[model samples]
Target chain A: MLGHLPYALAAWLILWGLYGIVTSRNLIHLVICLAVLQTSTYLILLAIGYKAGAVAPIYADMPAGTVAVDPVVQALMLTDIVVEATVVALLLAIAVQAHERGGSLDPARLCALKG
Target chain B: MLAPWPVALPLVAAAFLAGLGDKLPRRLADAIAIGAAAITALCCALLLAGPPVVYWFGGIQPRSGTAIGIDFAIDANGAGLAVLSSLLILAALFFSLKYFDKPAHMFQVLLLVFLAGLCGFSLTGDLFDLFVFFEVMSAAAFGLCAYKSREVGPLQGAINFAVTNTAGAFITLSGIALLYSRTGALNLSHMHRMIAGHDDSLVLAAAALVCTGFLVKAAIVPFQFWLADAHAAAPTPACIVFSGAMVEAGLYAVARLQGALFGLPQLRTPLLAAGVATCLVGAVMCFAQRHLKRLLAFSTIAHAGVILCGIAVLEPGGLSGAGLYVVGHGLVKAALFLCAGMLLHRLQSIDELALHGRGREVPWVGVLFALGGLLLAGAPPTAMFFGDGAIHHALEAHPIARFAVTVASIATGAAVLRACGRIFLGLGPREPDAPGGGEQDEEPETEAAPIPWSMWVPAAFLLALAIGSAWLPREHAGSAAARMLDAHSWATQVLDRAQPAMPSPPPEEPLAKGLAHAALTVGLAIALALLTLFRKRLPEILRGPVRAVWNPLAGSLRALHTGAVGDQVAWLTLGVAALGASLVFS
Candidate 1:
């Protein structure tokens, strides 16, 4: 029961973020929603690495053969975070450019790409 | 050493080019990127011919049947794709030399990074590593899509592309996390061995998430709305990459994963259904578009569907056919985009009606476009015909996929042929206000062009290479499929350092039937072109029923591909949920 909470929270975060993206009116909001959507994965990665009553992965002062949470997923999460940062930065830049091109911030108003 | 070089070389070049910044001369940047790509392609080609090799990073080989470090599992199939990606990057860089006006400083850097990502994605043995490379490629693509940031269309395209793709990526990561929690391994071979005969809920969900995510990347139905807009907004050089290599890379990943990790029987039906739907929808959309680039983009989607159908069959022959088809379709598609770019360069517009009769100025481009259209429809003696033939031979038991492939070929080919007839030969009377005003005021690549040799040479070269792909050794491709499909040998090669021992490959299918199939499709494409161009002159009986069925469906498809992120995400959410539910029950 205790271990499942983090995963359930991760699921909730994903669904909430997706909902926000689907209902988002503004371009910046949509990008933020994307970021939020990505955050769920980070949580899942961290949750996969987490251990109950376990020490951090660092071993500087720890005794020999100490129990530690898995470190690989933490590393994966860090790389994933970096990826999310770059994607969010790119999307935000595009949003700003879209606004500067005399286009409205509302996605409904942006019809330059329609069939 | 060779395995890592294909990925490492372009990355180093990208870093050096990025550091060069504004001080870097455009020609020098182009030369460096092209050099890196050429070397990468050479390394991949060598790898494809040589024995299978597994290169471990930092000398940290697998211990106790599992890996702790990343590895590149270089095989004929992976290396073949890497080679394709590098060649496309080379072609795109060559085209960009004269295609972009004093562009932003990061253009060459991003292209190199994108190539590096594709190579890494193609070669990586770890699931997590694939996601990282996917991000690297997609980030570069998003930036490239909005190269002209001063325009609204490009920005919208970039945003929608980035958002939908990121959502897909996030789902994939969650799936990876679930798989990790179950087996505690990121290595594909390790995971394959861990769950040898299990079809548990967690694994099923992971497979679904992974499949659907890559399916989104593959631009399958309900997740295909972003592709056309992205292509429409991107520069012509970038369009060559987007259609030629990037989307195909998506299919490659899906096929790789299904063979490596998930070989579930239930997975095939949904995948086949999606592929057929995308095939029909994309072909219909391709025919309906007045935007030339959009038309080509939809054709790519349709071809991707055919390739996906081949892969979903999960047979050695099916995979081999899909592999050859990818190379042929990619080269022909690249050539067609180049021709379109040429027309846009010299004529300043890509709208069918706007450019009508204006192409008389560039007769060579028209010739190339027409040839590409014919080859794309599966004309004989080209790689496409051989590949299409192989796939048809594989699908003898399944008629739906065969029918879809043929119809899509005829539809896309006819659409391109019609555009050619109107634009190049001035066959049909022009409608002044026909819908799909289609990207008016496109900024041309160059103001001064008798069509530079730099531009036309690459298109002619790609087309020639595609034509010559007919002679590719069938045994090599067959052996590649043999090595790829047998998970036991693949895992053994990676985990146990065992010599690779694959079963004898499936027998090669004869090409005679495929030749007839190609001839028929090409003839149908030509006839369809003539009919569409002169449809007003045709009697109502010949055209009326077709219009009744096509107009309503095309209208809805267009409405669905509204280029709106919210609607696209809504479709994605619904599709993924449905896919996941099916997986759970299966």
Candidate 2:
């Protein structure tokens, strides 16, 4: 049960973030919730990259013999982090515009384009 | 290296255009955007002359027969899609020359960026790379949708689009991570080679999540509320690309991923159901719309559903037919949207009811508009006609789908015909005293501003190509379909050279039955149109019953699309959960 703790936490985090998005009244909160949901992916990647008794993957005349955690997953997570930043920045900008134009960040008030 | 150019050239040009900024002469910016798009189109065309070209980025070829490097494996279908996107982008740029009030360099840059995203998504073989390119494409689209951010409507629409699609991207990323956790492979071919013989729950979960992500982007029902708003709010040129190529890319990703990795057997039933539901919903909502752009957007949703059905059949005939349909529909839809854009720019209103009899003066555009409508409706000698036939042939084994096929075909045709009648034929009320008269237009009604040649040429050119493809001999069409459906060859070339030679090809179906199917569909469409146009003339008893049945249903459907960001996010999450449930149960 303890070994599964990370997975449990990741799943909970994603669902919690989704709940925040569902109930949040402000656009800023929604963007932050999105970032939180995206962090679950980072956590999963880090978990997959882990190895018991593994050393850093830098091979510059390091320890004579050492197992290494997967470096590729780390690279992927880094890239994902960058993408998350870009997405959040853009969403925040749009949210700011929404607040300015609609006079409210509440989605309930933003119905100018509805059927 | 050369294979990557189609995807890279546009990005390079986009950066250069951004640097040049608004100070760059308007014509120079136009020239740069168009030139880059043309070259990229040329590159994709050149790739078709050879076998699949596989490129390894950063000179990091797979080590020890394991795919550790990012690979771009371009098959014939991929090449075909790349050419379609770039060509459409080219046409969009050409039409935008005089469309916008001012020359916005950012618009040109965004178009190039969008082109690159489509090209990259088409050619890349890495799952994560596909995700990256998908984001790039979608982000660019969000920008273009809100390009006129000074307007409240476009900004709201863009927010809804961005928020929902971001959630979709996260779901897709999580799926990729899940698959990586299980198989430790990001390259689709490598993943396939590793997981081919297994039927694990983890794999099912990943597939479902990935598929849901793409389906959301494709605007499949239950996840499609964003499309109509986004298309209606976006500039016409951008709408052309969004409707013409972006949604198709989403469908292509779904099929490509399933074909390369999961082989399409487990998820067929659910996908087929989704396809039918999407088709029915889109068609129903399409006719209910008053805005021309929204109507076109819904039609795109319907066509996406039809293509999904063809794809869900998961046979050579179905896949080939889907390819032809996508190409044909893309061109037809682009022309229609361009014509709609012309009307919007010139008349300043897209309300079909208000625009009745207003377009009769532009006879040439009227002709193009009529042809576009006919092509979309699967008229004879249109590529869609034969493509629809192919889809019918594929559904031969699924008897239950006959009703779905017939209703979808008729509804799709009727939607276009309905728009044509309201816009051009003046079939609706002839209220000459309508408040928003066409005479008090944005441009001077005194001079009757001459329509730009740039706009008409692209619409006509695309219309001719869409219909002209029908003239190809039957044998050529058959061979092209066979080549596209040669999945064994695609797998070997893209995944592993050591795989065995492809088995014998499936027997080709005759086109005669398809023609019969088209005839029945078009006839039903005409009947439906007449019924709609003369509904007021019907007996009071029948009219009352019809309204009773439809009014409440359409009301609820519209209510579901509340245009609130939070509601859209909720639906997206619900969609993901439903997909998960389907994976587990199936």
Candidate 3:
């Protein structure tokens, strides 16, 4: 049960973010919630790459018999990190623009185009 | 290998353009973008002429006979998509010269990067690589959507799009992570092989999440609120990219991944149901929209639903029809948007009522708009007619699906035709629609702006491509379909290369039925247009029931899209969960 903690934690983080988004009023908070959700994915990736008793995945020629964690997930996590940074930056920029132009970042008032 | 050139060249060019932002002349920047797009299109054409090419990254081979390393795999369908995207990119750039007033070096760079991302996403065989390319494409799209950052509408649209799509992407990444944990392979084919016999809940959940992400981008129902706002607020050239290829790329990801990786038939029922719902909602909303770009965006959603129906058939004929439909739809939609752009540029308004009889002076413009409407109606001798006919053939056995497709095709066609009649043929009231309804000021006035040859040329070129394919020998389409449907051949070629067998093209309807279907579709569109033109004159009894049914449905649909970012995000989350539950239980 304890070993499954990462899965539960990742899921909780995702759900927490969803809840935050559903209730959030402003663009900045919504973006922050999205970042929180993205962090869950990173956690999941790290969990997938984790090994119970493994050394860092490098060829130092020091541990011939030692096990190594999967490097692929780490690499994927790195990519995800870069993507998250970009998305957050872009989202923040849009939020700032929204605040400046629309006079508010409240999701309720950002009704520029609707049905 | 040449397989990577389609992706590499555009990246290099985009970097150069972005780096040289103000230093480079605007014309030079535009020329470089056009040249890169043309070369990419040529590369895609050359690739389609040959067999599938799979280029493994970093010289990594299969480890002890297990597939590893990322591969740039370009099959005929992938090549076709790449070609379509690059061609549309080229057209969009060509049109941008006159469409944008000043130097837009950053815009050109974002467009090229978006082009590279699209080509890469279509051709990549690795799930993670697909994710990266999706991010690249989407990031550029966010910037492009809010290119005019001073405007509240565009900024709001971009913000809503960015937040929602980012959430969706994170969900997709989570799905990828789940799949990786379940099966330690990122290569699509290898993962497919690994998960062949597994019927685990985890796998189903992951598939659902991945599909949900693409579905959001594809603007499927419940996940589609961002699309109209984004498209309507975006610049015309950017709208071309959004509607023409970007949305289709999302659907392509869903099709390529599901058809190639999971190979599950359980998806058909859910896909069919969601597709039908999407079709109805798109057509109904399209009918209600007064904004020209919003109307086009809704129709894009509707066509995406139609394509989904074709894909849901889970057969060779369906896949082939889907491929052809995407190509046809992209070309026609881009042309239609370009024409709309011209109207907006000239009159400073895209409101149908305001543009009434306005196009009468430009006979060629009217003809082009009418032709585009006919093409949208699936008129024969256009690729859309053949593609729609193929989808009908695929769904012949499923009566409900067949009926849905018929209604959707006719209704969507009717909506576009109605626009053409009102705006071009002056079929309706000459009075402005809902005076001061906040439609006129959507775009700034550009009076007496001469429609340049550059603007109309790309529209004409895309229109010809959409229609000219219909005049081609049926065998070309047939062969392309056959190639797209033969997943076994694709898998073997990329994996083992032992079997070189190719499947023959599926049988299609005789020319007479296709002609009849085309006629019926056109007739429905005309009838709908006439009805709309004389709606106020209709008998009270006849209009009462129609209004009763339509008012409630439209009201509910509109209420769901409250234009709030939080509301949209909640809906997206619900959609993801709903999709996962349906896939798991079904």
DockQ for each model: 0.68, 0.53, 0.67
TM-score of chain A of each: 0.90, 0.91, 0.90
lDDT of 1 by residue, A1-115 (tens): 9768989998898999999988898988888888888899988888888888999999999997899999999899889889888888888888888888845787767765332
Docking class of 1: medium
lDDT of 1 by residue, B1-586 (tens): 7888987899999898888856777667777778988998999999988888999999999998979999998887788888888888788888887776675447778888898888999999999999999988998899899987777777888888888999998999899999998889999989888877887888989888877677788898878988988887788888888898888889998888888776676777887788888889999999988878889999999999999888878888888888999989989999999998888887878888788888898989999999999998989667677778888888788899889988889999999999999999999888766555334445665674678887899999999989988888877887787677777888989999998665676787766667678889999999999988888998899688989987888888777776778899999999888888888985
Tens-digit per-residue lDDT, B379-475, candidate 3: 8777678878888899888777777777777777787788788877888776645643233246642455878899899999999999776764455
Off by over 4 Å in 3: A112-115, B435-441, B445-448, B471-489
**Candidate with the larger DockQ of 1 and 2:** 1
Stretches of candidate 1 above 4 Å error? A112-115, B103-105, B437-441
- Model 2 segments beyond 4 Å from truth? A61-65, A112-115, B430-449, B471-491, B495-505
Ranking by DockQ: 1, 3, 2
List the lowest-lDDT window of 10 residues for candidate 3 chain B: B436-445
Q: Which 10-residue window of candidate 2 chain B scores lowest in summed lDDT?
A: B437-446
Task: List, residue by residue over A1-115, the lDDT tens digit for candidate 3.
Answer: 8978998899999999988988988878888888899899989999988998888888688657678999999999888888888888888888888788778878777674322
